[model samples]
Target: MALPPADDLPPLRAVVEAHGLAPRKALGQNFLFDLNLTAKIARSAGPLDGFTVFEIGPGPGGLTRALLAQGAERVIAVERDPRCLPILSEISARYPGRLEVVEGDALETDLAARARGTPAKIVANLPYNVGTQLLINWLTANPDAPFWTSMTLMFQKEVGQRIVAAPGSNHYGRLGVLAGWLTRSEILFDVPPQAFTPPPKVTSSVVQLTPLAERLACDLDRLERVTHAAFGQRRKMLRQSLKPLGGEALLDRVGIDPTRRAETLSVAEFCALAQAL
Candidate 1:
């Protein structure tokens, strides 16, 4: 039977019990059974009338149902856990052409190419262990012509803070520089640990990142090299920490103080260093 738009989807708990699926910690699965919370997250992506939502780890399909019900034109949900495949298949059947379940690890998949030529919005209750890596991959992939229009994702609260962190904060590091340079990121809301099926120890937050229409020209590889070297020895002054990447000579040429630490350097400074490298 065709599901009634998004309204007829069963309660997530019922579905989970019926399927006898217990979220697997090894896979970083934390199912969100609450419709209200899922709907809130889905709405954070704004109206999805013409967007393809690329979701990672749509366990039991809570957020998937929300995305579909909210009128997303299409949703390409990538699942790594085989246990969730049949559940996801049921969701796909309900929505018909609107949902595509790609059975594979999101880390190894090239989602951008799959959605090629089409604008997409990535919204997911990302698997905690792989969430940061996935975000980095999406941001660093052909930034000049990004596949997704925006990304509203869930992450550990600390990771969310790091994404929007400014220079001089403890949270500021390579992630802050990358996100600061490429997108406008903000913490949308906090989702308490109790919200999950088996609550995590730390709280979680939803972060939304919208890419800049124009970004400074910088080679991604060089930028990563510069950040890895600098932040790798973050406590040491740039003179000592950046020794691998030309150290004082590079800082001197760029008008930066070699005595300054990595945590205090602005995103622009990092981009400058990357360019000069």
Candidate 2:
């Protein structure tokens, strides 16, 4: 049986048509109109009774509606697309004071300040092109104390795998190292390509990342430098791939085997190397 409508408002399809809002390729837009899926994505962030949700790219407000209906205390949606503003405005009207639509680029918006030190959860079907960069920004933003309590995001399957990939795995790289260093991340579920409006070519997955109460102490810049050099030539031995960064000597000083490949090094090992640098 079909799930009941998430809210009393018009269906997402009608909302999309009425607003003449088509997904734009330049913005990496792919509309997810399934209320069931959107609700599931919102719930994956855990209980929303008192937490404010920071959502990016809420096109036509499908996920916005689900989050409000699911009882999120407040939703601060940052949307870059001017065309989506009015559509989201309608939903804001429906929900009264529960929604705040910020019309601006998410990259330029300071989410930490917008959240105003409240316990916040970031839940969004992130745009594909800028997803990884966005994740990197959030991870490196405040190492001492993350701006948000938790993040539940959607990415292409490959990107999601990289976020949760382990040492010695094919997907392990800079992303996994940074994410592992700061948060405990995992792939919650895979979303098939067919589920989207202008269905994407590849499958997508939802990943959840919870901040570690106590993170390892290491220079974030140094870690990025090491990972960039090591993975820049992943197939090469550490001694060869990282030659520019004091290479073999640096690894030897850290007591790491210079012959080990980037993918074979654990997150802790990487942190040690970064500290040695």
Question: Highest TM-score: which candidate?
Answer: 2
For model 2, the run of ten residues with the poorest summed lDDT: 1-10
Candidates in order, TM-scores: namely 0.96, 0.98
Candidate 1 lDDT over 45-85, as tens digits, reads 99999888899999899999999989999999999888888
lDDT score, residue 199, model 2? Answer: 98
The Cα local distance difference test for each model comes to 0.91, 0.94
RMSD of each: 2.9, 0.8
Residues 1-277 of candidate 2 have per-residue lDDT tens digits of 6788888999899989998889999999999988999999988889988888999999899999999998999999999999999999999999999999999889888898988888999999999999998899898899888888899999999999999999999999999999999999999999999999899999999999999988788999999999999999999999999899999999999899999999999999999999999
lDDT, model 1: 0.91
Pairs with steric clashes in candidate 2? none
| Candidate 2 local lDDT, residue 9 | 95
